[model samples]
Target: MLNAVIIGCGGRGQIFAEYAKQYPNEMRVFAIAEKRDYLREKMKKEYDIDDKYIFSDYHDLFEKGKIGDVIFIATQDNQHIEPALMALSAGYKNLMVEKPIDRDLKKCILLSKKAKEYGAKLQICHSLRFAPFYRKMKELIDTGVIGEVKHINQTEGVGYFHQAHSYVRGDWANEDKSSPMILAKCCHDMDLLVYLTGSHTARVSSYGLGGFFSEKNAPEGSSARCIDCKISDKCPYNAVRIYEERPNTTGRGAVEKEGFSNLEDAMRKGRYGRCVFRCDNDVVDHQVSNIMFENGATANLTMTAFTKDCNRVTRVMGTYGEIVGSFNDFEIYVKPFLGNDKKYEVEKIESGHGGADTVVVADFLASARGEKEMCTPIDISIESHAMCEAAEISRRTGKSIEIADIMSDKEGALL
Candidate 1:
């Protein structure tokens, strides 16, 4: 059986590990490195790992020599590069790294190059590539059902509560610490656009701002913490209402999964209980990017935190027809200029990230075993990251940034 070691035992890492249980014969977790004692112990118990195989520091695991056939790096965005470089240097030949390999463009390029130099097989967790929804879309486009793509429009509706939880008060709230909203949240869209169009992005222009989740926008009577706010009952972002209430009104289970016994306890101990507006958050809540591809196709992408539902809505227009879809419904509608229209519904699966988590794990294991090539290898994944980096530059400078300019800078850095 293929063996794997997880470098971060957080929620995403755990999700990846669950696949091993689902396909016990294909692969299994042999070890884990987690900073949190509880989480590390949880993995150790679940995987039946020995104490010697559990590490609080990933560096320690790498130092002890190779422990598995593959390494899964699910650390935070900024924390990805060092472990990845170290893992490759330590003779690990297969790596599954979470996306945006690094927030900095230079670091991303360097890590990608280093993996190649080390002859490592690298897969970035652009998991959507393996999801059924996107896979069907790719099939339709590849068969020319939509004809030659002319323009595409896509939107990522970050539900209001989710925006507050992830972008306002969570680990990814700050651009300096993690990445810009475009990279942190919408790189998947950029990647999909590139993948579907099968063309390199030529130029990108974007506009965005951190509009609502800030101290200036805080309700007049709101307190620094939701637990102390006078309007906690009425405020939509009340941490207690979102976390403490059983089957919470917001319909999200992040706090429950966090194992917080009560709202008061969570407020006293966790960052999730902090007031969204009062937190040290700086990422934008809304952004729009316009892209021009080398093949003359154009695209527009909008990401916003004010939506009532969390879904990706996409409309792809081609020379002879168009395809429109929504992830929430797992459905697609296609209308041709000269033929009969069609509808498709993707069969739903339970794994997180739209059933991509498990499929990607399966693919990674297959790739490691020399059975098949990875769907989202580092070379293909890096293009999307470059598009995101250009979009962020355009957002800040108020000018369209050329992809060639970004690539040239990387070349100059290498020189």
Candidate 2:
């Protein structure tokens, strides 16, 4: 059986461990490296890990010199590179990392080069690529059903409450601490645009608007913390509503999962309790990116927090036909310029990340054994990440940058 070592051991990390739990014949969680006592203990008991393989720190696990068939790095946005670099140096050949890879494009490139240097296979958790919705779209586009892709438009509605939970109050609240909103949230869209186009980016420009989720926008009667706010009952972003009533609304890191005894006390003292408007978030609420592919294809991406739904709506217009899709429903409508329209209802796989989480893990394990080709490798993901980094730069400088220049300038900061 292939053995796996997990770093970080958070929600995403635990997802990797679960794969082993389900398919013990194919793989097993041979090692775990995490600092959180509760999480480490949870994995230890669940996986029946030996004390020899339990580590409170990843560095300690790495010091043991590469003891597994593969390593999965699911650390925070900024902390992705160090563990990955360590894993490669420790002689692990198969590695899967969570997206957006790393917030620093330079580090992203460095990891790619290091993987090449080590002759290792590296995969990024651009899990959307593996999702049935996008996979079907890719197949249709490539099979000549949509003709030649000429233009594409994708919109990601971050969902009102979801945006407040993730971008305003949680780990990704501040750009300085996490990543630019575009890279953090819309990188998946950027990656898919490149994947579907079958060409690298030629140029990219973007624009963003923030400040709506700030103190100036706070209601007149709203308090600083949702738990004690006088108008908490009326406020949509009140912590009590999302925490006590809808604790399972978002992914991990909820007070309920964190073992908080008092919900009100947690809301009063924790990051999620802060007012969406009064918190220290600087990421944009809305942003738009314009991209031109090398094959004369163009794509427009819009991400906003004002939408009622928390999914992507897409339209891919090609030379002779077009495809329209809604990720929320896993539906795609293909219409030809001269023929009748056809619709496809993708079979939803019952797993996380729209059934992509398990598929990607399976792909990683199979590819690690040289049995299947990976769909989202480091070399391919770098282009999408470059588009994101360039879009952020274009937003800041108000300039449409040539992707060629950024790619050629290894030491430049365009990425």
Candidate 3:
């Protein structure tokens, strides 16, 4: 069986360990590295792993654990590159890292080069690529059923509820702590656009703003948490009404109990610091990007946190036909001809993104054993993340940035 080591024992890390349990024949989570003692102990009990294999530092695991065949790095956004580089240098044969490679494009390229030099099989974790629905959709497009793609428009509605849970109050509140929203939330879209066009982006222009959710934007004389905030009843961004559908229910809602009553309670007993409004939360809550592809194809991407849900809406106009689809549902419409009747199809995919995480892990194990090719390679993910970084730059500069220039300048190198 292929042995794996996990760095970071947070939610995603726990998910990986559980995924391993379901793939007993192909893999096993032999060890994990987490700095928090409570999490280390919790993971040990939850997974029934020996205490010796749980380490306080990932480097310690690399130094002491049996030679790991694969390493999965699921650390926070800013902490990904360090553990990834360490795992690679320590002779791991397979590596799977979460999206954006790193907020710093330069570091992504450097990691790619180093993985190549060491002959390690590297897979960047953009799990949606492995999802059955998106995979099938991509297959249909590739088969020419949708014809030559001429233009594409994709919408990623982050939803105010989800944004507050993930961006405003969640782990990714500060841009400095976890890359910008573009990289944090929309990297998947960037990858999808690249995968669909079958060509690299030529140029990009973007604009965005943190228009709605903030202390200044919040109603007057309001507290941070939903329960104690006086305006929780009317505030659009209140966590209780927005997320859990209960403005009065505190502590047992979607977020931890500590942050429910007020910002003071949040600071005293929460992961995010007391400076909820003052922390470095500079990431945009809404953004739009216009892109030109190498084959004369163009795409428009709109991402908004004020939407009502967390699904993507995509419309593609090709030379021969046009197609529209929704990520939340399996409904798709294709208009092949002007006078022809529209064709509707219902797509059914398995749960958990149609088992994307399991499929990707299986592929990683298979490819590492020289058994097959991987769908999402290190290079493609790097290129997509590079585009994301470029879009962030374009958003800041308010100018059309040439992807070619950005790529050539290695502006993708670490932040």
Candidate 4:
């Protein structure tokens, strides 16, 4: 069996570890490095990991020498690069890191260079690439059902509650702390567009603003915390109702770390209890980007926090046909210029991220075993990140920015 080491025991890291429980013969967690005592102990008990192999710091784990064949880094947005570079230098041969590789372009480039220097096999968890709905879309596009692609439109409806939880009040609420909404949340969509079109983004122009979820929009007479607010009962984003009443269902990390019984205690004392409108969040609630690809294809992307929580929706137009679909229904329709339209429905699977979480883990394990190639390599993933960086730049500068401009060094020299 292939042994694996996990760097974070949060939701995403735990999701990867679950694959070991489902397929014990294929892979298993051999070591873990998590700072949270509860999360570390929880993973140890769940995976039957040895005490000697558990570490409070990733550096400590690395100092213990190579403990497994693969290192899975699922830390927060800004926490990905250092651990990745350390792991590669420590002789780990396989790695599965979460997306946006790094919020900084130069650091991302450095990590990629180090991985190549060490001949390490790396896969960024662009899980959507492994999802059946997207895979089917790719297959259809490859078969020329859509002919030569000319334009595409994609939308990510970051459900109202989800946006509040993740981008408004949760860890990624601030651009300075995490990343721009485009990089932190919509990098997957950007990557999806590139993967589907099979072309690099040439230039990007974007527009976005944080119109809602500001101190100016807070409800009148609202208190800082939901528990103390008089309007908590009626407020849609009441922290008490979201965390205490429906902790098991609504709370993401809290569900795993705090549990349903202690949710009230956690929310009352944590950042999760802050009023969405009054919080220090600066990330945009809505944004749109227009992109031109190297192959002359064009695409538009919209990300908004005002819609109902649902799967992504996409429409692709080509010379011979057009395709439209949503992740919510796991279905797609293709209409040719001449004949009858065709519809395809994906078989449902009970897994996170539209059944992508499990499939990506399986692929990572297979790739680690040297039986298959990584579907989302670091080189390809960086292109999507570059597009996001350009979009953010464009959004701030009020001018279209070329993808090459963002990828270039400070001297304006292309790397």
Best by lDDT: 2
Candidate 3's residue-wise lDDT over 28-113, tens digit each?
77788988776787778877777778889887887863467888898878788888888877888688887768887778888888
Q: Write the per-residue lDDT of candidate 4 for residues 242-335, one digit (tens) a residue.
A: 6664554557564454443366665777777788887888899999999999999999999999886646999999999999989979899999
Judged by lDDT relative to the true structure, which candidate is superior, 2 or 4? 2
**Where does candidate 4 clash, by residue pair?**
none
Q: For residue 71, give model 2's deviation from the true position in Å.
A: 0.6
TM-score of each: 0.95, 0.95, 0.88, 0.95
* Candidate 2, run of 10 with poorest lDDT: 248-257
Off by over 4 Å in 1: 244-263
> In model 3, how large is the Cα lDDT of residue 334?
70
Q: How accurate is candidate 1 locally (lDDT)?
A: 0.86
Clashes of 4: 0
TM-score of 1: 0.95
Off by over 4 Å in 4: 244-252, 255-261, 410-415
> Where does candidate 1 clash, by residue pair?
none
Q: lDDT by residue for model 1 over 292-391, one digit each (tens)?
A: 9999999999999989877898899999999999987889888889879999999788886678888899899989989999888888888888889988
Question: How many steric clashes does model 3 contain?
Answer: 8
